[model samples]
Target chain A: MVSGIREMKRLPVGIQTAGWFDEKDPAKSFRFARECGFESVDYNIDTIIRIGRDEAGNSYSFMDKTDEDLLQYYEPFKAAAEVNNIKISQIHAHYPTYVVGDEERNAYHIKVMERILFVSRFLECPAVVIHPTKTPDRGQEREINLTMCRNMIPAALKYNVMICIENSLKRINKNVVQAIWTDVEEINWYIDTLNAEAGKEVFGFCLDTGHSHIVGRDVEMLIEDLGSRLKVLHIHDNNGTEDEHLIPYTQNPGNKGMGQIGWDGVIKALRKMNYEGALSFECARGVKLLPEGARREGMELISAIGRYFRKAIIEG
Target chain B: MKEKLLVGIGSKELLPESNLEDNLRMLKECGFESVIYSIKENDLKMQANRHVYFGAFFKAAKNAGIAISQIHFKYDEEIKECNDYIESLHNALHICNTLKCPFLVIDPIQLKDSVQEKEINLKIYRSLTPVAKKYDIKICLINTIKCAGGYHQHAIQGACADAAEAVWYIDTLNVEAGEEIFGFCLDTGCANVTARDMERFIITLGSRLKCVHISDNNGISDDHLMPYTQTLGQVDWQGFIAGLNRIGYEGALTFDVSRSIHTFPEEVRPHAMKVIAAVGKCMRKSIEAES
Candidate 1:
């Protein structure tokens, strides 16, 4: 019941798993998101794509089950999204596609991802997030990242899921350094090159607010830079240091001295770009760390903040 | 092995209202032989001349019987500009030199890409090598837990979370610098959360194990509780002591145990300091027995 400005261009407010939803119980989390007034939810696909190896060293396939069984597996997620009237924003895929010396593991993972794509498509989720490749050597970074998408492009096309490459940051020597796909220039190049080669919009960019904050990237400027190509968002706030993933403003507990990310500026840029995607809050960890009794209230407050931002974007 | 147990406490425990000399006196009175100093953001920001301020702070520590074993440059999260970051790092090195502290512990910020992480970390650390060498202080990169939220969002742990990565980072830095300039600080809480076996990690780091943050947790979030407080899901103390002995670690057994003590009522911290001193003594005894 977190009602705000009623307008045709009102961007729908969304929420992530937010640590309240146990992976085993998707219904409870989605229902909570719905009750909190979130119009959409970014489903964490990591729980579904569990990759394990047997004694024979062959990868155990979750997809090897009967189609009926697969339907049963997806029943909870589908029912929750339907009953709560929540749209599935995107399935955040397992990151670092190139595990060091684990080609079999990566291959097994891609197979699982292919199955998730089918489930995502069925749920009408438009996008899925896969991280850019991380290698020890910088020279092979671009090629490795492209190859990952190249291999999965056909599956993505078949399932009609747009793979969104998220911006990421690494902690190096106590300084937040930009990783692959963090730079706007690199992201533009990667997205442009990938989509051009695929002959369609198979890959796009996911702007992670916390990742941008930690590396000192201006979220508003980045949004403006990405413009129409930015398909998704992983919105969260941090106090300029460690990815604390706190709520947008410095309103939450335990954020006395932390830096506040500028949400108004962010909304201004999104409004300028006429962003049509979900305004999802990836700020779940901040609330999850609260005492159990405070969680529901904390979640409501976060949802209210989301509505506030949505209202800001619409009013502007 | 030295017959006397050498122990220290994080200077973060010292209230900002209180000056260094009074805190050092209190530490000396509490039986802490050494102190691990921390340079707060405010301390650097408020002071017009930081070098002079640090010099005076070190003078006060020397006046007391407390030796500064390590200086922690409080992690600056707002440093987005490279020039600002370098300036802060230089200030850290300057503080270390002023205090004549042997080790400076830091939590490196994570980059998105691993290659960029290695390249950027190497470049930054390499730039600081001369300052470290000139001051005769070793730079120790500490391990970190997952950023804000656990695993879902990609918050890169520092370039040295894994044992092999730590070795490679330190070895490569040292080899390039043509001197043993860098080392690793293992945080017990971080190790537990990351599922890193402390014994094996110690064995891997060997001589590169420069400093340590000793605290207990439930192996989920970083609780930073007093040792043995969390009886369940505690770190393998037996293995921890054994590994230190195996590596012939002769560094100070500093208690990064702050949350537990800091959370205590202000009036009760004095007694808590004594308890920390006793815990440090007991751990040293156990480590010595293993040796």
Candidate 2:
């Protein structure tokens, strides 16, 4: 009977898996995500790759596993998603893709990212967010990031998963300054140039609202400028200073129209551009702020805000 | 060589429960040499004979071998009345005297216009001079950021964010009081949030810096994270150490990293505090190192 009814277009609301669930059990995390009204989840693969050596000087990285073993390790996540009926919207790749002057480490990161693309495909995720390399020099940052993305094209094409470059911030002389891809035109250029080189759309933009807010960029303008090239979103809010990764509307509760990110403008712009990707929340701080007993309430509140965004974007 | 700074933390997270005796003992167990007592309105209003609870609090701190270095008065923007705010501060001074805490860190009230912000805060602090003098507590004005919504959307300089202005306020207030009654507490996180050069700010404050709120951020928001944990080099630890060393800062290395601690899983919080203490020791050593 429902098949005959015309269903309205609705964007899926999602959240990250970092803080909401037990890392030991993907099933529990996915189930919790489902219960919290999230239709999809952004799989956090950052945990598997230890950025630095442990206290004993031992390095741990799941990317070093054989393809078969890597897939086997993530089998539970796939099974959990199937059982929970929650879509795997995207996977977050380990950050600092290009380490300045550390060619050996940078090569290792690319290899890890190539493996991450394979994992993303296996998990049925359509995209992966890779942070841009940060440095004081803009030209050097651009060249290194471009080379890094170019190196990932083979893996991206093999896995059929789009590479998403996020807007990022840098610290210069103890100040928060804009990094490469923070400028809308530069981001557009990266995506377009990568896609052109790949002979297809292999690259897309992941707009991190918190990053944009801190860098003093207009969220609405960024969304509109990216247009169809925007494939993913890291929706979060802050008081325009730190990257707090807080829930939207929580920043300016008094609605004084001052220092917080303008979620209203964000929603309107997404609606105008007809953004189809999930309104995913990368708000780990939002969940962590609450005590363990009350973390579910935080997740539920974020999900409620996600639903509000979904309603506005769809109904408008 | 300069004396090593004592490591301490705010009582907000350490004192999760109401038992002051147990809380002070827990702080000592966690490797803190000192603490900043966070006084709330409830604590002020509950005690009709205020000395009863603070008396026990003082005894507990002494017994636990923890020094009560400073007291934080709850600044409520909701009160909307100057007299009520002053009354709460007056009560806080009484508790500070009982605890024998020397410094009281108070935030400057921010308003839309700079003149109004300065005038209102000056008036409020001026009103507390009499009570502060009676308690023999040096009132420390902390730097704050203004987050006024609209075209200038993000955080800009707020009350006392600038070192020159903070020095002006302290000097002016002290001259008006006919003694050294006012001092400055440099909140590193607030300074980082506003993107001020930590070394320059510290150098400017120099001997006037009575205390510090040592925390880090991503240079945008006041995340209050531990130093050197930020992915971006937002807080200049080298600059901070250099500035403190140059000034020979003798106060406690007090931290306000509840947000950073909360980021970890509940079970890992104890370990997190230990790491923070370890970092504090490292920073102190670095500051005292002959450079």
Candidate 3:
């Protein structure tokens, strides 16, 4: 007898750990995520670093730990992922990579990122999402981010982790406007330039659906432009005017079909590109706003939505 | 256009029943310029001293400097068979007049039989028109969705779920009344549940659209989640704002996200209200800017 059913490709669905789960307890966090129907997680390593000043005006962070100690500190997260059968698909580096005119702070951010890349390798994560710097001058913004990425090249190459540059937004005059890497051409240029500098494909793009929507960038077109260079995703929704980081499809005002993001077009574009990355949710606000007891239900709903997207992408 | 589109919230979840004055003050502090006074059946049935009860509520709202944008009249299933339901509606209209609210949003009577559904709702709305007109209030029919098996089940089209049918209901009622008395309250969450394209619905309704119950949801259920806070792409907020802009909507941007608000801890509810008001302000700005 011959079986008639063909096997289907199952895409890994993931969620971020910053606001949804207790990151201090990696064992519980990974287990809870797996229980909530997630197969992967975008480890929010940014929480480990403290960038602001203390009461004494002294900056401090977990980045003060030695390389070996930091790796040991995160060893349990790796073990927990293995035990729960969850993949650490990606790690998010601390942001604001270049604070304006603050050389010491900017240097500290670079040092933190380098250490994070090292820890990401220990966690067996494949990608690290690093945000581009924002400045009033477009040229200065490019120079700052390019230099930052260039500085991370050695660590990225050594650890074999792809540095994923995410599209960002900036508030100008109380209005959100497109910032560094929001445009397809601008992002492509950054990825291409960084990869060229590294002598390999060490750079990739992490498309943030919420950020793109806030700045009125067409998600489908952005995905199509990034194509194979897109290695990760920060899937979330917004009302097109604010970076709310909401769950998909929840932003329609007055049920008037005024949703800023076109999710169907987004899924279709991802399908067309044959994107092979986890559908990771970066909707921390969605989970954070819910009461503690209701968070698991919220995560389950988000995971179910991911399954819907996965089926649509694979079958369509 | 900018002045007309003010941000507001429903009082059902955001305000504590015991401390109406303090809560209204909090709402004012949270940047809400208007509020939809959610009237329950009991509130309407308070009978002899109804004015005494609602007068204080109105006083608190006035003191807080918040406009009573509208009144949400909660409906019971047995409304068609009960004479008390009609009386309750009259009472609500009276309260609306007392509160100086311009619009009163009510759900259409949904009978199992479609013909009866239309007949009963028309009679009910027609009966309320005398009092509505006396109070100088517009009776607004909200578009609703029916969940076939129960909650969380697939939502199908309910009364006035279609734009043409909604328009027909309003126009027929107004024509019969010999004046414009009935308008529409578009519940965006209900539209999402029934998969109605809001832009088309709003455009079709045009000037008849008077009020809105702005909320978000996954298409499967009427979750009443905050706008821009649900599963991605389930609600089309862009099209919603565009439709409002196209129609030059001048009503307050009132939010009815009670379920979403209830999901927050009691202590966190105030902060959640702030976020809701902020989202409303952002939406109001978008609509006004386009206009």
Candidate 4:
């Protein structure tokens, strides 16, 4: 309770498991995250997209796990997180959840979302990051995303967790262009509408720094616009060209004297908006590419930066 | 001429109990010498956990003295992300390498537009060719056939509907890849569903036939029934047997007929399997007599 100077809230720094590329066990990765001084972790659920499919050709995932099975499956992770004193920030749901041209398949994807909600509750997590539905009808993107939200919100409420709709960027497939909720305004619309309709904060936003950087949307503006509705963060840097989730301040290859993102600006904007969540790093790709034993140094550097930013900008 | 008939079965037949050792034992008991192995949903999770390795699975098969003639891999993801799709295929290919499986079969993805079908199929196979080469496995593309109004039609709308078109597809991939890793998996049930001339189709496959899914249909649907079922519309068994003998086809006469066998009660399945084994024995004797 120091009085004169404004003290920075000791917001926990977190890391997602996907960045621990080769590390197969979540318990081991969570231990490492704790040792590296990260206080929380964004657990990744789709590290290895195994090739086995159901009869209808849907890839099996945690969604396929029954309640008893899933509980047994992730119990070790829960124990590790508890023992390491690391908070479970959220679960990162598998991407490209939107199925095209098939009602049965779409229903399957929704079922997966419901299972994820149950998992979120099982893990005692407060939120789950869900990608917006990607479809061909750009004009109807908002409606489609809303429809998906409506479909999952009851389950979200039932599980007492929040579904954070992450903003996306344009991606092409088979010569057809699909625009997910790439625009900030549309995302704002989704959050506002969902929260308002639910009469509570049922839906929130997960600002993906890499996706925002790729689509060239202003990170600072997004914070200002989102205000308190932003519940989670996927903080990572990338070369301006691709969604390579590199560690913050890493040099972008072939781009002399320029890094992918301005971490200082992002922190400053967070301070302005007074974000309360953990400063989670989604830079596992950068971490994985390091020479075997050198990865710890990389994680240490990341944790140090997280502390530095917290003290310099957030503390002031 | 091929040495023995090498009657084969699909691993799917032993599902629900899905114990690899037990399945292999059952297949052997049923007189099956070859099998079309699939990485099912549960098996995939087991592989991820390191609890069930393909090496061990195949070793049990080897101990049972059964050969994995081909692997049926149907990827669950839509081909939206090319690299992701390629990566999934690479994992499956690695498993094939572990099992030393010689052939991998896939149902060619169907797109709405016919003109784009060839290009898409070529692009997908082209991406998979390097992995196929690395694993020393042949990629076999199966044809698309539909049954409508009691008549079978080779998919006039999808890629590689006709036998010649299938050969052309495989050849195009082979030339572009600079290797003979690409080939055709002639699904007899698909042929029957389309009412195709089995002899002509087999001749067209010629030396390019890397694997075969020898099942029967009633010309009304791809029922995956046992050969000589007679209940299904007639499969030209004589013409098909003669065509393989004529081409000197060395591949196994593998049956992807679990769908029909699975219809019977668990107790009756072994008996149904005996019937299939008898038919396979008959076919092999006939082929060997010709040789």
Candidate 5:
């Protein structure tokens, strides 16, 4: 076994095979990741909240959700991280509708993020990420967005968790249409405007690889412009049109993974920027679990990319 | 190992005094090829490595030769962090894959508090389907009613507060999406109130009938006792098991007598497993005779 390029030493590089981080697999997905030798992962907050509840007791979800009146379920995550030797580098919180919209829930959201921050700090994670929604059509959606965000900034300030907003990728979902304003130009404008208005670096964008692909944004180009300002990346591959979040360096049916945008170049750009966070496994491919010594192809793919990062990018 | 049917006794079954491996060995000896394993809401983190608590159970299962067929994630975790849960699912799926178990059962997370945030729920179903498909493990949602306590009396409300609507909604979404990834675990006790149809629900669920959690309750409430205990709700136990037969449900029928076995704490769990194993034989004979 040619030991992974020695220079690849602790690049803080991670992959998103949920198995290594989680117990989520067909018994096969884990085998693929482990056999391949990648040991980091990211997960959905919902799984943490609903995994073991009776019916009426599950009032807690990861997203700062509606009517935030319930108990918190953060221990599962703390325990899961410890088991896998995986650290939660970023929270990847869902839309904080309750926090941004309601003041009380806003306080709760901050407290929750702060709590996650305590864990993230232990994990040495740098950020807590989320997706953005268009404001409800009250008087001013922008105001609601800003007002809700205004409360959110303090939470980020208190916790060491940098709050980042991600673009929604449900191009076909009519329901999300109202809360959608993720055109790249509109996003850059949103970032600049929000910061200028707040006069603080309170929030940033999470580059959702699939969403950007859906919008036909060149991954490399987005990296170049958004690099320094951006706070996170929801990394995964997809067929060009639909957001079928697939593993990276591989192409989906209709579109080459990353579409016309070159995967190699995108990685090169991200490497150039020295993005030290997670290349979160936001998609699914074939996965498995096994009795033992299981093989994980996804981990192999991630390891391959890690090698590329170490060899051509880091060395170069 | 043939994919045997089983149901979780609830992860809260993990008592401090419980000998994880001892009970697991008993589970294997009793011929339980499947299990609906769970973790407490607070213990969801520790449940992952499984080795922590079940290191013995896992090793024993391997040694005595049994398969962990199903998973009942009975704890509460964040849905938005589904990305992380997917990771956990990967591990759960790993167990299923390890045993070649066919199905994995879970509770549908209601992140959005109301019947209103249907879209978020839909997003969740859609999001996890890919992983479900990738793992080749059948993922199902279990409906349940919490036995609430008060100064006046007691009751069992459907799992997740109005799960019937949500399960119907999300299942429709997944089915419409042509994704067979979402299904129901169909707890005998939980179905008392939340199940859409006692007979038709199981029959229609057909192959989607992954696992059936067998428990009983008084007509007044869900007691989760052994069969012949409850006469409540709309479920026909004999017919429901028949429904499992009708739907061709080949998964485990986990006998969750957790409350009953709580004191013994893994001691009599296998004895209970033996009783359930007998029940499994009846089920197999009944189904095979019918077919």
Candidate 6:
């Protein structure tokens, strides 16, 4: 009985399905992400992108209304994910849709957030994930961003959804998270302050392996510092330099790599933190695969991940 | 009546080890009569931007009783930095002035669009052309493709029996590019994926070519599989080499397969050779037909 108990204590992966979970699959890809042993899955929230004008001289609408419309696009995908028992976790922050200025615009953003929360609740998800903004000129000038969030959190609370602010890797010349919070130190302070002010856990942190690696932090150290407060753990490999986003044990298998984040160490770190989420993979494999092939590859990767986790962890 | 073409396995085929002596010895054992030396950026950094491979290449070629066919200026995206471009030029000029190879090979990064491609192409000439002319070494460009710039803008289409129209695109570019711009280095796996007729393309190009990146492929796609892997890349091995014979083609035959020797070494290079020998059977037929 004790031995069985010990076996059950293996890797308590607190992970979500990254769209890139299946390096190949683009369509039906999320299903593959679930098969990769990820407990949570993410989707492009606020996908009503205003790309450009069409021949009719109207804006190109990305997300049309209605479950029927969504089902028409996601029928096979939803069915496969359901059969696989994969749960939805968070929506990538729909910032472009949710700028709070006018009452009507703010109300619309609130409606969108409510709809997202409804779908997530129906899916039995615990939280919604978002990237707040591109890094601003003054790193960690969270006053403006905080004021906006302070105003917005009430609306989020009304939906009973926990918002998980994920740290984004640098783009071009800036790390997106720092524009809001200069460094991890400031991020920790903000989380502590926000939690205290709310008198409840308003938001939590999503630890992205590549982002941490890029910033020259030991990812294992982060798990150690944040402990159980670390909610969503994004599991992906990068070679310290550019975010190649490859599966573990594939890229530069010999050297410590640029990110200096090795696979075995990361798995061991996850176990150490006693994380209770999904180990999401957002990595690059190849670009040229057909959508079907891409999704199928995503499925295979998840199962392989399960096997790896099952082997790496030892329960108490 | 034909040159028993000097086929080489480039240093890249045997990576991880930068030792020219050891690589040359292996090349000899593998019976590759020619070689295209690839210099890595790390080598550039550690060796202080010296043309270490160039001197080693000349010595190894003579010692191994092999011919130095082409010196390749390896590509890296970071070459946009002036220092890296200078380092690349140093290596290229090293081969040009020091090594006995008659030609220098440069494969510029595939441009994403014709606009950036024109810019990069101009960048390529602006930076490297004078260097090639300075060393008096004939410069040749190779084509490749992906989602990026027009490198492999034309993909392989096995549907048509070696599309002659697509093959001419490369020949025409070679004509337009420049002086000392010797010709094309027809990569067969590239042709397989792009679906250009190998023999027909070469025949059409008619001797403007300086080299061949010999590799076998599975018919399904460009696997760069060892010849005989039942990939689409398999040619009548013997007939293929013999066809080069028919064209009176005399240049380097280098294997440009992309797998790292450190990981899957034992399987790939030797298989490349065995596939060549299998293809050699077809070349025998071509020889007999000619005779």
Highest TM-score against the true fold, candidate: 3
Off by over 4 Å in 4: A1-10, A21-25, A48-52, A56-60, A172-179, A252-258, B1-291
Report the C-alpha lDDT of model 1 over A1-316, residue by residue, as the tens digit: 0011122124667777737667677788788788866888777766555566799898775665665787788888788878888887777886556665678877876777787777777777888888777766877877777777788888888877888899988767877788888889989999889888888888888899989877878889999999878878888776566776755543211333334576767889988988777877787676655434445645665566667667667777
State the lDDT of candidate 6 residue by residue for B1-291, as single tens digits. 534555566665564446667767766765566667775556555666355645765776688787777777766655566556655665666656787667776664553364565455545545555666566667665656453235333343321123343244344443554553445666676666565556666776566667777665433234453333231234445445555766777675666544422222243344334334333333333545564
Badly placed stretches (over 4 Å) of model 3 are: A1-10, A52-59, A253-260, B1-291
Worst 10 residues of 3 chain A by lDDT: A1-10
**Could you give the candidate ranking by TM-score, starting with the highest?**
3, 2, 1, 4, 6, 5
- Report the lDDT tens digits of candidate 4 across residue range B1-291: 434458888875574445778778887987788888876433453467432467777788899898888888775545666676656566777778888888888778776676786677677788889888887899988876532322323333245668888888888889998989888888887787677888898888898887778877546546576565332255888888788888877787788888767544354466456556656766776666677
lDDT score at residue B183, model 5, on the 0-100 scale: 66
The TM-score, computed over Cα atoms with residue i paired to residue i, of candidate 6 is 0.46
* Candidate 4 chain A lDDT trough over 10 residues, lowest sum: A1-10
User: What's the true lDDT of residue B201 in model 6?
Assistant: 67
Q: Tell me each candidate's TM-score.
A: 0.51, 0.53, 0.56, 0.48, 0.41, 0.46
* Cα error of candidate 1 at position A275, Å: 0.5
- Cα lDDT tens digits for candidate 4, A127-180: 888887665676666676777788887888888888888877666652212246
Residue A122 miss distance in model 4 (angstroms): 1.8
Q: What is the interface RMSD of each candidate, in Å?
A: 14.9, 12.2, 11.4, 30.4, 23.0, 12.7
DockQ of 3: 0.07
Q: Cα miss at B139, model 6 (Å)?
A: 27
Ranking by lDDT: 3, 2, 1, 4, 6, 5
Candidate 6 lDDT for residue A177: 28
Question: C-alpha displacement of A47 in model 6, angstroms?
Answer: 4.4
Number of the top-ranking candidate, with DockQ as the measure:
3
State candidate 1's TM-score.
Answer: 0.51
List the RMSD of every prediction in angstroms.
17.7, 12.6, 16.4, 21.9, 22.6, 15.6
Off by over 4 Å in 1: A1-10, A61-66, A251-258, B1-291
Q: lDDT, candidate 5, residue A84?
A: 50
The lDDT of model 2 is: 0.79
Error of 4 at B95 (Å): 62
Ranking of models by DockQ? 3, 6, 2, 1, 5, 4
